[model samples]
Target: MRVAKQFTPEVLLSAPRRGPAVPSPDGSLILYTQSAHSFDDNKTLKEVRLMAVESGASEQLADDDKVHDAQWIPGTRTDIIYLKSGDKGTTQIWIADGADPAKDHYVAAEYDAPISALKVKALADGSVAFVVAGLVGPDGGLFNDKTDEKKSTGRIFDDYHVRVWNELYKAQKYALWYSTLINAHGKWGVAGELQNAIRGTTLEAPYGMYDVADPGDSFDISEKGITFIAEDTAPSSPEYSGISHVYYVPLTSFTAAPTVRPRAIVMGISETKAFYANVRFSPDGSKIAFLHSSYDSPSDVRLYMGHTSSFGAYDVHRMIFGKRPRLPPKAFEFAGDSDSLLITTEDCGRVKLSHLELRHDAEATSLVESGVVTAFYPLQEGNYERLLVTSNNIVDSSLWQIVDVSMTTQARVISSATKHGAKYGLSHGMVSEFWYEGVNDAVVHSFIIKPSNFDETKKYPWILLPHGGPVSSWLDSWSTRWNMALWAQQGYVLVAPNIAGSTGYGVDFTARIYRQWGGAPYQDLVNLMEYLKPLPYLDHSRAIVAGASYGGYMVSWMFGQDMIKKFACAIWHDGIFNLPVFMLQSDATGGGPEFGGAPFLWSNGEEMEKWNPARPELLRNWKHAPPTLIIHSEKDYRCPITEGLAAFNTLQAQGVKSRFLTFSDECHWVLNPENSMIWHQTVFEWVEKHIGGKEARNF
Candidate 1:
């Protein structure tokens, strides 16, 4: 028998991660970026790789430390573009031929300023158009920091739009620059001048509140034009009203700007009340698709599609509507023809792929139902008859497969890392789930994770993990931040509940948390505890509850109610303590309608006051609060650090045993590998101190 390696925080953090796979135009090869963190070196290593579909063999294309965002140029085989440091140490566009690198592998273009979020499209006339995000000065031109220097260290803001997320507003703002790739004497290079798409406009693409720039998710380019999302700057204060609209700019001449201003693609919803995301253009350029979630009905996200003409006019219609049981639209892509599409939805506990016809009443049928689909690519070579997919489960990290368009056939696993789980003593048998009667006669779902070692006779303590988002759910998938298996390794059973407000169930169930944060969701959690009471294998007295974001908010809510006495201890990360104050400080802008907006302007006001955990009525229960650990990051603008500080101060003032942990360098989540290790160790030690799970900290 062989001894298996212990799955520690280091092992979990350092595991290799594959970025979204991009299939080649001909579907003969697939391109993706692979990265892994190394605690020994205190750095992350990355490589761009290409895998042949027929052979399951992959080869490294680029491994330079500077390489980032590698993308395939449309309409070409093996021709790629990526970002890397130029001669002046500024990020620039670099290109190479994967099949014949020796013939062409060099710098293709260099803008004076650093740029990122590259998107490329090949035009009908053999010309290539590309867009990149870079900092722009007040004049709407590329900002040259050396030339347009700001000497003042002092800052001033006259409005609520002072800062966004972690970054304080500076003189320059992020803007998208568009230019064409010109071929001169058998050599390719970007045009001499770059046109600012939103020139003279106060709008922003990939919006300020978005921590990362995912151009692909927010924008798409077709031969006729480009469509993108930009926040409406007409509002007096961006911090109070968060709404974005999709805009289309026709592209007839690469050298000249469009005659008309970027036309907003109307989705038939109020401009000030709708939230749009995941805008995409079909491969044939005949249709467009995007998701719309209204502020009035915040939880219900509908998929809408529109036909496009040559001049960018849209005949938009609601393609899919109504309360769906297994629907949580993540992303969609047009298949075979403009008549069919592929969508990924969160079903039950899993993120499953579904096939949908373009008609309004067409129902989606599950195509890949077993595991969570992380990413998918539709092969154009087969008229969209095949798909390249990447999926994972609770025990497995990465599983890549090739599936047919028809629902009758089983998917073929082209490449998988499932066997790698055995190296860490992980098996599928360790994971299980059950459904129970919850609050409001709803059937709530919960996933159960057990220790890898076999021993059903002994009773074990369990941990309750309520997921964040209030809108999100605990999917049956692998996660590095909150690894269920690794948590179970601490000699305790782990139960993750997809409560009332969670997605994947149905629209009504998801909308239950709105304006009643501590109502039905709380009752549902209590119901789960009641359901778990009779289990012979679980010790209810030694129970622990832990959550982050909205989950953290629930912890604070639990502190106010009589439920605090049931747990040995608790952990809350970036939770909302004072609801009204959070509306004022959060980047989400007035907490939207989820907290119930006032009939008259500028405030969440008294509507949010009722649900506040720090209200005078609820404060009386803090004295009896369980010994707890509160963690907050300085850069968490979504749930500002002030919320955590307020909770900690109130708990301490109430004489409750508690400790506060702060990470100044981290954002919403502790993503740095070193910081993650410290976080895991601290959390593990705290849990052990209260619940007597001493063997949990194997590291």
Candidate 2:
């Protein structure tokens, strides 16, 4: 058996960690960001660095504390363009040339206006085109003026809308402005502001363009206008509750008049809403690539490529991956030329990359088999490169290597970090695979992890860690802060089972647990315990069930079921105790409606009644609950704190030991550093108390 190296959090997040390794137009150098974890400060920092691919030598370009995205200045061989903070919190354009760090110049530094959103485009001529958002007042200025007035009035607010309305009322009025930078003359052109247009009594502001490029300082090409996909509440019929439509505005004409009208590209009168949009153009700007999906199910995104000349038209020549009955497409990159693209598809637990040629009715050639391709980039004109690849076999950490098309290549340093002093050493961990028969001889796949220093002769307590998404899969990654790792560090074995519904394998596998709830999947857990009870190193009597969100639902369900007496405690974080109540109180107020507003409620009233632990009648009769700890956040609209409180109160009424903790300033997930530390501390202490004892720390 071969052991793979271990990676530190710093290495996993290092800048240019996941995105495209975009080289300069001239290809003299390649720029990428490496994200590194600062253990001292407990924060991540992104450092932009330039590498001469020919020499393999790299140097740090600039270190802006808040810098995120960076790009090179087109037509300039020695200079790079980046955004930096000016006065207040406003970001302005800064130019750095050669290796000189201090000898940098700022374009339009005297304007004192903020650049809310910016992009640099290299054009046919040796100039750069950019956009800036300017507003009246100080650096951190906003658009509306009534916001500060409302805030000064000092009124208590209970909802997010009221708070946002007050802030908008105080914001300073602003508009989108455009300008150009001439590298030949080293000067910025006069700025142009956008004008507003009114449609049906509602005024609209310019949202800006996707790409901007300057040509010889005097002329510029700003293409790919802003398009918004939003849900339309007004419908023609009761059945057609709402529709999702795309609205676009050209950058050049947006500020002049209301001549341009938005054309609807995709029209669907349903309950589905667009969550996010990723738009990309071919190298020659002749075609565009877009990924669209619903917020409720983001994994269902479908990729489409369209021609640039045909506005609001989707090219039928393009292929749709998720439209078929299969796993959703993970990611794709255009390679070889504008005509060819590389598509990566993942289903259930396997990932495959293929070369997709647009010409000749979309032909595809497979590059690899079932495995996770962590990162990839274009290595040559026709061949794409793979940076890191890992297999489904959890025993091995992902191996980082440079693989070219037509052949395979291997490299060292697969894991991000080795021992600090040792030049290169492998990281150690165990990955176990087992199948437990559940509900009619159906096998459920599961993964287990023992402590780093596992002793087969000694017995170890078990922590059952359930994933948040009921339909999501538990992938093998070097996850440092995963709950399983936290417990494994404390001398507890971790068990994560795919059960019947978890994703990765296929749609059928995921759909099985949809309405099952506390059914087949729950039985899988029982079977797992039964399978593990006889193991020499396993302490069947000492077990804990813990999960968040849907997993939380399972944890609470476990306490209610008369399955096994081996578990000592359970931990629920923002879990759903009752399905009917969850649907009613959640931010999604219209019930679990489908695409056509058809309610996809639970299977039957009996299922709903049986699963809804929060029902008034059920709460009154409840007696046997577990020693449970419930944690919830005040701002979690998904699984609201109300649900947590209801469960806690019901458990207490039944004489079951239960505790509830509410975080005031957190959302569904904790974000604040200090608050996060406190939350983790509390969680570990609870685990220690229930799981018997803790192991000695190695460091």
Candidate 3:
């Protein structure tokens, strides 16, 4: 028998990651993108594949080099549409046969600007209406090429949207443009000029201004009309505040703009500023549903649904359950009945799939219990009785299954992870979970990942990985950025704690981190380290801790207090080192709310200073700092590069060992495959140098 090789960063990067699967019109086949890094070429390879849903067989449908965002052409079985990148760096639409994609032909005029997020639907007039998102000039046209050729290199922003997560606001804004495919003289091509759905307005289609991934479903199109979430362009509204609304644009003709202006169908409530996302219209165009969250209660995202009308007015309300599910939903899809939904919610470290009814006192029934359901799509074959569910766990990266709508644990495996696991020598038994009482007697949960070659009698150095989202939980899912299993394979025990601020535990637990960033959650980490110190299998003295984003913020906070003494070394990436500076210079507007109101607003800078790690008192203790690795990106506007530089300088001045690693082309996270390899290698070397673990040569 062939021995399974050890899992390495190279193997991890080479592993194929699947995108959201799109089902065919008849629900007999699935179309999805599989992407992986080519170490030899040092670039990502993407392939569009077609799969037989019933048999679980798949084949490549398009050239990976040039094709992307492929979708079934609404009403046809073999007909499909996708975007193709040209040699000149322009992206255009192409139509192809699912069986013979080699004969694909371009269907529309290529625009100067690139487009993405393709949505296709069949209109009533035997024509195909397609919508794509792309940047449009200030004049609401395709693109303003003159801005690219301007002699002066300057950007004048008089308002809040000077910069977002990684890039500055340009002359163009993202808008949804639509056109129809017409068969003229038996040759398929676009009918007329693309009509801008949000034309004559300052609104942007995608409501993304803060984080990397755009907030929610920016827009969805149906046979009747198009529904989209737009950024509130009112002078009073701030992009960082995440003020957005859902608007409905009725369909007139694909060749012309909407006869009537887009109007708000869903608005925020009185007290809290609302952020909307995942705006999905029901399979039948008669109804709509989406995920809703607010500034005050960002973690308590709930599902809201309403019926659509011809007059363009709709009453969308939050579905209040008699016995609410303890977990807040992440994403949801409407059932064929249009009155029910299949929602994936984070629950106690695992994402559960639940069935929700849309009545007065409805409750979500838990369907799938094991593994995290990352995405799910309802099949039209059984009147939406069956669903295509894609999930993963700590050990397994990818698994696709077909599950019925009923409450059952059984599912037919369509894509198994057995081969992938064996290839990398991964085992499910390596993962386990434990809980302990934390601050205020609140229960804190954590996942423990052990090395594949288990030896319980031997002591292993442990790595404490705090997740990024101070508001997010470390779910039981696979992640390329920070793969726990891969980390554990480096001859160490990996302990990922879901502390007070983490979701999936409860709303109260999640909200505890608010205004008390360094209080409950910090104590929870301290208590956790203390609890783990007594365990026989762990080398408590050689403990190493690392995190990114909010996790990095916590590491910075730990350096300020007695908690820094617990770990041998630390790694902080894109963390907020100085709260006052972060509030003023960060891309986010009014960055103070997460810190409990703006400095000039509610508390007059008191709230921002209360938990700041860079406060004068905290910096005095930097003399005893541990060996540290600081990683920040130049393009990161969220935490900004200044935060990293300031922290590193303080450590250096205090005679503490520290190093700074940064990527100019990357953002808040190191997404480039080569950069990621360097990141993993550097982190491992840092840990091995101080805590004594697997050497970089062995890795």
Candidate 4:
């Protein structure tokens, strides 16, 4: 029971912290991207780096101002193909061969029209196929040239007449050109113009199979072509808002005619309640894996695989299906040359690695029981014999290397990394799981992290940090630099709860928080505090509730409810204040009928009225609002700046200690390194002022 070296904030913030450590096909090299910030430039860039797997010698590839979507072309002499931000805000493809950085070449030129290339797959024939978008001019630019010519002529006429005809001709020319670009590259790109392009069938529908309006998810490319999962928002079934369907475009057809239409492969009706998770294709291009669940079934995400060729027919006989035992499947890998896969599942109590195999009848069998397999990776080019596994027992994010293949197997830890009892002393914190009965007696899962220097004899301040996606959960993993680790270093304990609406457990557990929003989920936060009040080491009198987005909404709601008097302060980042204003002011991109509808608000108007923090009357009724910090980005289109501004203003008007911080250029998530550092510094300083003593400042 000897403890190993603890992971520190510096180590966690270092390069190669997270993501797929996917090796090149040859296994001679490994390609991965790291998020780095240039102190001189003040920008955040994802730099692609290559590492020699055997020697562990690594070097940087081309540093395209911003690099993302990295893929290796499969062949004898493979090259890395990636997307680079080009001039005029376009993303062009660039290819690099060998380890020579200067030899990198840009494949496509910057197009006058907006274009995006997605999911590049190198074909056996030495050609790459990808999903691309060609944006046309605004308002069906068919009349653009004519209108420009007329505008020029009118300007000349106005110069001669001075004030007589300039105003009249200017208005007319502007109106004439107002007709947006209806067609681009022979494809209909506009939404409203019907005659410009065929609507339902002829012209590509906006919410068809290939178009993924949200950029958070990734698409897959196969030898057959490129496939993407997108939400089908056609008005025929308005209730099927978040419903996602698969679409495929043949490589040959796409190459022959770049404007070729994408074919719908698999379609499903989501009933406007569920979330369409990630879609991954099998190595053989014969099967597709995906997760699907709704609000009522939050914790349960059913993992299903289907034959690629047979779209609607999800024959379980040809694929494998399993219910993920944890809250979220962090990462998964298919075993090399075997009908099995390695999955990483995190529950509130612990993180587990599971070895799942597809039986002869395609049934999934779990190996290593529940807590044995903690983290796993299947060895390549061999039988399913060895795996890279990491495990934990509440206080450690232990990293281990396991050499095991079957269930009745013995695992030896090749290397060990722990959070305490090392040469350098313990620098990491422990993750503990706790659960309590929530709304409807539903079991709510959560994790608490005590600081590295935690002492059982001393009472420490606490911070309740909730995740953004009411569906997202906090797991047993190392902390990130952006995570509230700075607070922990200042002697504060952090609590992340899965509550009722988190994924990975089961569908029913996840769906409990649906439109109920301000009800059960908020109650769960208070319940967690009540459960933790008696803990000997926790200082319940100096607690603070904070979070971003949905978590921010929870903080705002908690402040209004007077739930916890011990809260000295609260921080709300990009949170929602008024659901109605949020619904009205927000764009049509993320929030639609699928998420929570405007009409549904009318049905539950009382709940909306009672919960919305933006209501002036509600703000006036606040008797004991905590000292609050409102942080938001002006350019944030997701939660919008108005929400944060309203909350800050209301708190200030009520003579409560509150301040507003806005990042002018940042989005919902701060990507700039300077701003991120400043944000962390501010939070750390705030926590230290309220909770940290001189001893806590000694790091």
The lDDT per prediction is 0.77, 0.53, 0.77, 0.54
Can you rank all candidates by lDDT, best first? Answer: 1, 3, 4, 2
User: TM-score per candidate, in order?
Assistant: 0.93, 0.73, 0.93, 0.74
Question: What tens-digit string does per-residue lDDT give for candidate 4 at 1-699?
Answer: 442243333333332332344445555565665565555565556567776656657777755546666766554344666666555455545566645555635453333322333344445555444444332344532222322333244344422111210021122111100011122342212222212121123222222222223232335656664445545433343223345555554444323432344565553443335544555667776766655554334344445565656665242222343332334454455675326666656544345666666664343344433332334544333345655454533323344444576656776544333323242244434446677777687778876777767788998888888777666666544444335444564567888888867765664666666666777788787687778878898777677788898888877777667674668778889998887667545432233322354423555465556657666665665557777778988877668889999888878878887778889888677755567666765665565566544343431
Over the stretch 1-699, how does candidate 2's per-residue lDDT look in tens digits?
222233222222221232334455444455666655554677666677765645646677766655544666555655666666554555556666634435755554334434444445554554455544445444332333323244355655332212120021223333334445664466443234332322322212222111121111111123444333323433342222222444444444323443565443442325345432444556665555655555344445566555544554443233433234545456665674676676666643446666767664444566655335545554332235432232322323333333444445433222332221122122234556577777657777777877667899898888787676666766654433353443564567888888766766654566566556677678878787778777888786677788888788777676666652457777789888777667545544331212213222443355566556566654554455557788998877768787788778778888977777778887667655456555666665666666665553332
**Model 2 Cα displacement at 380 (Å)?**
7.9
Query: Would you list the clashing residue pairs of candidate 3?
Result: 217-278
**TM-score result, candidate 4:** 0.74
| Candidate 1: pairs in clash | none
Write one digit per residue (lDDT tens) for candidate 1, span 300-366. 6776666665323222224344333445587777675777778888888888887887665677777
- Quick one: ranking by TM-score, best first? 3, 1, 4, 2
Task: List all candidate RMSDs to the true structure.
Answer: 2.9, 7.1, 2.8, 9.8
Candidate 1 stretches with Cα past 4 Å from truth are 1-4, 85-89, 100-104, 145-148, 182-187, 207-209, 236-240, 269-272, 307-328, 380-382, 418-420, 598-605, 693-696
Q: How far off is residue 639 in model 3, in Å?
A: 1.3
